[model samples]
Target: MNNRILVTYASRAGSTAGVAEAIGKTLIGKGLQVDVLPMQDVKDLSPYRAVVAGSAIRGQKWLPEAMQFLSDHRSELSRKPFAAFMVCITLSMTNAGQYLEGLKSWMSPVRDLVHPVSEGYFAGALDFSKLPFSLNVLAMRFVVLIGVWKQGDHRDWSAIHAWAESLPSRLLQ
Candidate 1:
């Protein structure tokens, strides 16, 4: 039997975790065994045949733990099929083309560091209420005062599902 697929993520405020769960569930529906875990919770890559890793973006970079995971498991990961996704509100539906262009630039570190078979870019969810209390209040006030931050769920479920469903064959190819 093929080894299980691992859908691991590094999320702050949980949006990326939700995306990882959706991916894991879609793979399971296709009769693949899957393990969905946080990057911190993953201790072994030996059990997985392929990996789908993602992280929420802050400023313009992936979380430290996600980067560390890739760094720590570089050799093991290089031997298997891998795919990556990034979650950022800036990549909203309205700006998907820029998202594609930005994907290569933003993921340069990953590309330079490790090879992946495919990549995904997704719009992220952001709720000011979920941020730390002081930061939330500050961000809410900033939004009201300057209209810089957009707060809402912008993730496109159908797109995420379609991408997830394509992975098994993608790995094969």
Candidate 2:
């Protein structure tokens, strides 16, 4: 059986990439073949048996490039098993009720194109240094208003690993 899985991601400040890498590593440890790459670098899905795509949440949506990738490959993605994950600081910090509502808005667009068998939402790192002055000020205000703790990397590796461990069965079917 084909167990080759593509773990592709689009990250802004590198948090989603880290999660993708963790998922890929965990899948490999479970005796599956995995390839982790940025979405733009993935040339073909033919070599992959299944795909796990993720992106960093920006402005309440997946990055444009990530959405475009899904749009470009919607047919192929729908024909095979596909999974998606997102990394956002505010998303992970919100309560369960708000999380589901926020997830619907964030994941709705992608779901319209492809149906993912599995989905993940994770807290990503926040690096204000990467933002310009104007955006930085706005981000700070958003953080303060949201009542988030000190800004920094907040990813949960164990949760990521657990999610990865559960994928082989879903992906390989």
C-alpha local distance difference test of each model: 0.86, 0.87
lDDT of 2 by residue, 1-173 (tens): 37789999998778899999999999999998899999999877888889999999877799999999999988889988999998877655646446666566688999999999999888888777776667745867687667764577889899899999999899898
Superposing all C-alpha atoms, what RMSD in Å does each candidate have to the true structure? 2.3, 2.2
lDDT of 2 at 42: 88
User: In model 2, which range of ten residues has the least summed lDDT?
Assistant: 91-100
Q: CA lDDT of 71 in candidate 2?
A: 94
Instruction: Report the C-alpha lDDT of model 1 over 145-173, residue by residue, as the tens digit.
Output: 67554678888999999999999997755
Q: What is the TM-score of each candidate against the true structure?
A: 0.89, 0.89
Q: What's the C-alpha lDDT at position 106 in model 2?
A: 88
lDDT of 2: 0.87
Stretches of candidate 1 off by over 4 Å are 133-145
